[model samples]
Target: MNLLDYVLPCLWAFLACVGFGLVFNIQGVGVLICGLGAGLGWLVYLVCVNFLTGDIFSAFVAAMAIGVYSEIMARIRRCPVTGYLQVALLPLVPGAGIYYTMRYCVEGETQLFLSTLLHTFGFAAALSIGAMLTSSVLRALLPKLRLGRE
Candidate 1:
């Protein structure tokens, strides 16, 4: 893949995050910042998937990136991390995977259903683990990182 691959997806991710934020009534610069964070996270994921590793690893790192971005920005902006993190994380959600997995199951395609279900669950697990790890790692280094302080 070339620059277009990265640019287009990142742009789309940014727009999606922005729209989600708006629907949540997020105001001011927070919406734009969260959108940018989501875009950057998606860009990192794309790069990881295309050049470095599989979807699990890509999701893991992408999640970590978004977590770090949200945590840091929340401190600087004097807002709740959830305000940004929740919206920012939307881009990485495996909604399509979940839909297809359920669809296959409903259609009684045992083999495809099982495969999709497993993959979807695994991807969700990766996202959860990545978020947990990012928060844990950041918490451990909070003092060193000098965040969450005036």
Candidate 2:
């Protein structure tokens, strides 16, 4: 396991998320924070994938990390979680999976289409489920995490 395999990809993920944030007009410190969060989340995903060797598990962990970090950043910065979460999750979104699934379908490869479609949907469901779990836990704890405390 070479270091570049992980570090380089994580750096790319961070930059990609930052670019997406800028394109979407996320202002102030959020742009930087969102980018950092994406890198950290990607690191978690890569490490998980390296050890566990499963896409679904890695994506779930990465999505959960993004959700939790976004929630905390939102509380601290008084910004909406969606602003960071959406962009920070850019690394984990299964865009290529969906693209390939559709391509396979269009190419009349039924087996490949079904397999790719299921994998794509599985990844999406994993991310969604992780985010939902994080939101539920965070919502229950948010009141206790009041800002401006001494």
Candidate 3:
């Protein structure tokens, strides 16, 4: 894969997240934060998928990256992490999987539909679990770190 192969997707993800940020009424730096989070997440996803064996695992890693990023950004900016995290995850969502699954169902391809549906669910679950896991860990650890510093 050439540089453009990665650059283009990250760019698209950034723009898409920026657009969503605008639509969600995020102003100024918040919009930029959302866009950057998405771009970074996509880059992580791409890197993981290139080296990893499964797309689900890749999504999980990417989601964790995004989770860490969004949490840090939230702490720095004093804003809720939900907005940034939600928009950042959009690119990794299994849009194609859902579409293909529905298409197969409509076409009466039982086997294809079932497999696609299950895969889509798995991918979605991985993304959620990855992000949640990171957030939970950080929440559990940050207080301890602060106490240690004090």
Please report the candidate that would top TM-score against the real structure.
Answer: 3
Per-residue lDDT of 16 in model 1 = 88
Per-model C-alpha lDDT, please? 0.86, 0.87, 0.92
Q: Write the per-residue lDDT of candidate 1 for residues 97-122, one digit (tens) a residue.
A: 98998899899999999998888888
lDDT of 3 by residue, 30-148 (tens): 99889999999999999888988899999999999999999888888778888989999999989999999999999999999999999999999999999999999988997777732
Instruction: Tell me the spans in candidate 3 whose CA falls farther than 4 Å from its real position.
Output: 147-150
TM-scores of the models, in the given order?
A: 0.92, 0.92, 0.95
Question: Where does the lowest 10-residue lDDT sum fall in candidate 1?
Answer: 141-150
Q: Which candidate's lDDT is highest?
A: 3
Cα shift from native, residue 81, model 1 (Å): 0.6
Q: Which residue runs does candidate 1 get wrong by more than 4 Å?
A: none
TM-score of decoy 2: 0.92
How would you encode candidate 2's per-residue C-alpha lDDT over 1-150 as one tens digit per residue?
899988998899888988888998998788999999899988999899888889898999988998899888887887678878888888888999989999999999999999999999999999888877897888887777764311
**Ten-residue stretch with the least lDDT total in model 3:** 141-150
Cα lDDT of candidate 3 equals 0.92
